[model samples]
Target: MAESTLGGGAQAASTSLKNPRTAAAVRLGLAWLIVGALVALAFSLHETPNRGAAASFSLLIGVALGVTFQRGRFCFFCIFRDFIENRDSSGLFAVLSALAVGGIGYAIVFGAFMPNPSGRGLPANAHIGPVSWVLVAGGLAFGVGMALSGACISGHLYRLGEGYTRAPLALFGSLVGFGVGFLTWHTLYVEAISVAPLAWLPKTLGYGGSLALHLALLSLIAALLLRHLPELPAQAGGKLTWRRIYQAVFVTRWNPLVTGALVGLIGTFAYLRVSPLGVTSQLSSLTRTALNNAGWLGDRLVGLDGFAGCAARVVDTITNNGILIGGLVAGSLAMALFTNRFQLSRLTVRGALTALLGGALMGWGAMVSLGCTVGTLLSGISAFALSGWLFGAAVFAGVWLGIKLRLHA
Candidate 1:
């Protein structure tokens, strides 16, 4: 009887392995195991003596950001494209919500750090950049790049984990572009950026006034965009179950407001603990390091190190930004796998060339402006910098022009 039972169990196990559903279940289980291992690695890194907690924390934050970006479809270019082509403003609300929430959170933190906003001193590491024609030009170029590449810098990073075939080329092009920016930095810095004003709202308006104005502007924008928001179709009511809850949370795209609020909270905490949320520092650093090592770039980039936005410097070790980016990609990959969304895309010559060109434009823009959309626009506005507003406007205009010209096509 024992021998018969052992044989029967073996047979059942073999049959299960052959079943398609069981195979899929096995794959998903493996994916989850990989994710769990990554989480464990993060904890292990945190406990390491030399690595410290910051690296681990940055990794975790990056993972959270990755999951959020993927689940919410929080690509800036995608959001703008939807608004421009489909007349859908629902995604735009996410941006407004994030800015509003982040602004409030920043105000609280700023109050704690520097109670007197009227003083000349500014918050440390906040994304307050100079306002100038260079900034506007950067924004325009970045926007056009987004349209051509079908994603912004951050978007490309996240999508890279989603099996985007063109992302690698785009990123390489960005490196080249950064090299080009390095080449022109001295001229641009001396000509325009040197004289640009670094305008902080809190310097003039105080924290309370600045926060109020920020909310008011966001409210006004939301009101204006309300007309463009399409009414979503209502879902039929169904009995709630654990499985249903799981499906809702894991399978479907998240609500925009919820996504935005979470992002805002993350940004706030990230600023409080690590630094302002920016993605370009490591990329720029890598480009700079490569160029410098090859003896192609100059020894000094004029006024580059003194800037307030994402600081790109020659680095010998992995910084927090590097850890964050790694975590982001890993988290995104895990999420993509879990959702069965990780499929390799077909690559074409046209697609590759466009991605490279677009990425180069974006990289140059980011380098010149001292940040990308995520850095100069989102984080900048959250910090109450006028440059953020100016950059945002220029980007919008650039996107509009690109769309009109069918550049994205």
Candidate 2:
């Protein structure tokens, strides 16, 4: 009997060693150790006097972003598309929760930034663009691009880390589109978008009042969204314990509401410290620099540096934005591996074509709108920018149109 029991134990040990999940967990652990070591090295040995802190902080935030996005599956395109196609309101509710939490965070941050709170001047670096035809056009294009490409800019970055082959082509298309947008920027800025108003709710209503109104609106929206969603049954479980917590966080998908709240908090912290939550400025910089080196882009298009939003600026080394992006990719990749969700899929010819074209449209749209979903919609609305609202509505409309036309199909 003892010999038989020993044999069974040995077999079980061997089986555990060969488990794919165990292998994935090992890989994930190694990746995180490497990440931690690198971050520590940067913090300890960075050459810059004052910039090290910001860069390190940005990378940390990026990692948080990547992890949250991967676990929550928080792709804006997927969220809306799921609801439209299958009546899944989970993502929408998550979005509302994020926006509500983000609004509150922004309000507090804004109050701190401008101690007076009732001052006439807007907070620095807010993404409040002029409301005009250009904004609508940009939003529509962005939505269509997202639908066709299967992801947004942020989505592409994190997905790329997961070995999605199509993401590279989409990102490359974005670069080309940005170049095109720059070529026509002068005409657009002068003729249509330059003179539009930069509207902020806080300026007109004050911080407290704006907060109250936004909270109320968000509550109503959440309530309506709940009406559309069927209730999920409560799971039968015993007392909450450490193993359960670990399982919830690492072994299973996170609740969207929880994920959204964390994302909002990260965004708020990021903006307060480094800049607004933009991922494409680095790509824009690369494109612009390449154009300048080749002398294709004129000097007139170099005016974005003076702007307050996520405008591209030339840099010889990695900027904070680059660091944040890198962190996001690496962090998400680690998490995906840990969860055994890291996958690499080949693209079909049609899919490849769609990715390229969709990427181009997204790039152009981002340039026109001065931000993508993260920059314009998420960060902008958090800051109470009217342009954010306009752009978001337009994006929804475009997505609906694309779905109706079977763009993704």
- Which tens-of-lDDT digit does each residue in 1-409 have in candidate 2? 1112212233344347344445544666766785786577457635566567888888888888998998898889889998889888888877777788889899888888886656776787767677788889999998998888888889898888777888899999999878887887788888887777888888879888888988898888788778678677577679999878877887666887898898889988987987878888888778877887789976556445555666666656677888888888888887766666666878899989998998999888888788888888888888888888899999888888888889888
Query: Judged by lDDT, which candidate is best?
Result: 1
Compared with the true structure, what per-residue lDDT tens digits does model 1 show for residues 1-409?
1112212233345457544455556657766886897789788989988787888899998998888888788888889999999999988898998999999999999998888988766888889998999999999998998888878888888898889988888888888888888888889999999999999999999999999999999999999999998887677687999877777667878888888888888889888888888888899999999899999986678798988787589987778898888888777877776776666799888999999999999899999989898888988999999999999998887887788888888
Extract clashing residue pairs from model 1: none
Best by TM-score: 1
The reply for model 1, stretches above 4 Å from the true place, is: 1-19, 235-240
**Candidate 2 deviant stretches above 4 angstroms:** 1-22, 41-50, 117-120
**For residue 171, what is the lDDT in candidate 2?**
93
Query: At residue 223, what lDDT does model 1 achieve?
Result: 98
